[model samples]
Target: MGAVNLYVTEQYLLLKTVDTLQQKYGFRTLFISDARDEFLLEKYDRRINHVICIRRKTFDWSNQLKQDIDSYLRKFYQQPQLFRGKETRFSIVYVSNLKPVDSWEHLSKTMRLKGRKNATVTTYFVDEYEGLEELGKLTNTIDKNDNWKMEALPPISEQERQMVYLEQKIVAIHQHNQRKFEEIFQFGKTKWTFVLIIINLIVFFLMETQGSSTNSLHLIDWGAKYNYAISEGEIWRFLTSMFLHIGIFHLMMNMIALYFLGEITEKIYGSKRFLFIYFLAGFTGGIASYATNDAVAAGASGAIFGLFGALLFFGLHYKELFFQTMGRSLLIIIGINIVFGLAVPQIDNGAHIGGLIGGFIASQIIHLPKKTEGTKQVVAIIGLITLMSAMFLYGSQQTSASENPQTMAAIAQEYVESERYAELIDWSTDRIDQGIEHEFVYFYRAVAYLETDRLDAAEDDLFRSIEINEDFAEAHYNLSVISERENEIGMALEHVRKAIELQPANEQFKQYEKELSQKSTSG
Candidate 1:
């Protein structure tokens, strides 16, 4: 004897009905299904057991089906003698090929006559389209047995499906709202966002209070100052300028943009990652401003550009979620901003570009939490770190160097006279030190050293410059000067020629070539 067994087909309604009955009656029942339809049955009732797969035979052969069913039943029902010495009975309730009620009764009687007194069998002859009707008939059959009591099953209606879908949608909305709130309120615990906001606001207020100060700080005015400032160590000016705006309108626009973009980004990638992206982007903008612009640049636009870059990268990376639905709108917004940046002459395009790049790189790092341990992730992290380190070191040195009056005067004078040698000499002894390998810095330093009669120092700085940037034509040309001064005629001529090869139309290098040739001939 075995526990009561209930068999069902792949019909969803019938399976649901059976599940309801099982729960209500507290019956220790085993469910059996054909292997081909096992997944469908389990989707409705996961507790089903004794699944038997019927092979798709060309002919309807009872022997093979019986063998498979018998094997499945025996495997599940077989038990050995235990301390209780209890016997188990097997009763099968099957829902399949329907016929008259009298025909099912005859089948039940025949099974009883086969000496299986403890086994009770019930069958429902149900039409494929008449599943609901069949479920009712099956319930009636179970009720007729003295040992069985039928329990009511929940009714399935069109309204129920709609209610379930609505519930899921409500849950999704709640989750999204919760995430958004977390992003907006991130500053409460960390204080970073609050601090950044305070600093930016203060800078904005200072700029507004200082009348006519904004007018005097155009890109051209700032650009000239930056060239000299960098050599003397006024690097903070590069970053500080970005935080200052001309007027209330300027500050309002930038702050609003930051708020909206930061909120969106933070929601997508939590507060910690968002803050990292913001700061990195701002830093990159400062670097770009230092590298390209001479003017006093002040604004949060660089960070804004970074925000756009982050959004673009995230949309592309998670295309299925972010881009598939709203990608076009995002692209339009990005395009408009880029166009605006290009159109406005006052805008620090270099800072915007740098910030964008920084944001993109930062997004990759920030979004890669899923890639815990992989080659790609490792490379990305390393590459980002290296880039940021270089930018930081370069910006710090330039800013610090710019504040030195002697260095600023020397660089300005060297540039005005097109005296590459003078510039190099002034820069090498004063600015080029340990950990400074920028080609521009080295090239100018090398020239200054050569002009000031320090051939050995000139050669060292020239080679160091070339090492940092192999494509630097000025370094090569200066190397030619070092060779000429040292009386290495062939080496001087060769390096001068290489400089010409790198930049053919450069009048300075051409002039250097002629001088080197003359010096070589004289020697």
Candidate 2:
């Protein structure tokens, strides 16, 4: 025969029916419900099917009732006589107070006595207020089917109830512990604190290795070399030199400042974003060092300046919490650093200014994942490209001019001062043949050539230095003195006028100008 089917209003009622049906008829049953009833159904059945909840106003009674009744009849009544006795073949029943169709009571009574012999279906209504009375009615109605049977069922055991309660408790405890662990880790993981510790360790190592008892590295000395190289066109040294310190105090102070500022900034921006800002600051410091000539620079003060820039940007961008906490202090720190960088003599103030500007620009550019993608990244790329191009052009010009005669003359002077005139002469002669155009180099080489009595080479370099920089007082003065030595008064007088015009206030030029005027008047 076909399987038995049962439906109920509540999950607990469904579970109770399933238990009774399994004991009395050895039939497995399924439970189904909406969210309100499904939770309890799932706790009991584990494999219960969940359906969407239908409210009284929205429920379509026609479709739902038809579907439920059709499912029941298909499972229980659509079978041959071999499975269900011939008397019971094609028989089905439903037990509920919910009427499946209009005039269900009249139809139930009519089907019992007059419907097709064994092919009839019966529905028994159970009164919600009277449970046993309803069951009696259902049993009596199904008795028309010759194979119908009924029996009492056992109640659920207490042991099964207690085991289900304990399992729920264990699941709740596990969920609580997992939430607590996540909260603890989230509180401990901060980027600034971690970065501060690393910077402190590095500073400690650098100080231990380089510090001495009396002569210590000073920021001024480091700043001086830092400034000079950058001013003279050695720009790459900017990033490298910021880390270098002249003494213990220099390293200690810078490290302390970095620790505080970097920590604060990192806390505001996250580790990844903070790192980008820091490195970009360092790169800007290099650019600043290159732009100024008199200032020597060193230290992470440039990057510190950038942190202030970030503070300003972030404060303005996020106004609620960060701005109120950090805005004032950042402004003060930046102001103090500016005063120090600018007022200190022998300090590459240019580098400090450049670094500050660079830091500000870098801060503007380093996309901090705050809100929108800021224009800082686009600006930074363009600025970096422009600076690199300028450096490249400057380097190329210097390299191409290295072969000029005036450049050779300057090189020979160094050799002469070091007492290597013989080597200088050989080098000068070799360079002369290369056809350099710098007047100073040619003049110096000519002098070296003259020292070995190569007078022609000395005159050529002196003339070239004059040609390259007409107002080159040194070259003209040298040429004039050389001419006087050779008793070439006319040549001496002519070059002296050019030298005096270039540097009228220069004492040597003044004396030459006066001497030449006297000689001209006397002649």
The best candidate by TM-score is 1
User: What are the per-residue Cα lDDT tens digits for candidate 2 across 8-63?
Assistant: 22222323333333343333222223332221110111221111111111113546
- Among these predictions, the greatest lDDT belongs to 1
Please identify model 1 stretches exceeding 4 Å from their true place.
1-195, 210-225, 324-326, 368-374, 385-523
lDDT of each: 0.54, 0.50
- Measured over all alpha carbons after superposition, the RMSD of each candidate to the real structure, in angstroms, is 19.5, 25.2
lDDT tens digits, residues 211-232, model 1? 3334532321333225445455
Task: List TM-score per model, in order.
Answer: 0.40, 0.37
- Which stretch of 10 consecutive residues in model 1 shows the poorest summed lDDT? 79-88
Which 10-residue window of candidate 2 scores lowest in summed lDDT?
A: 49-58
Residue 469 of model 1: what lDDT?
77
TM-score (C-alpha) between model 2 and the true structure: 0.37
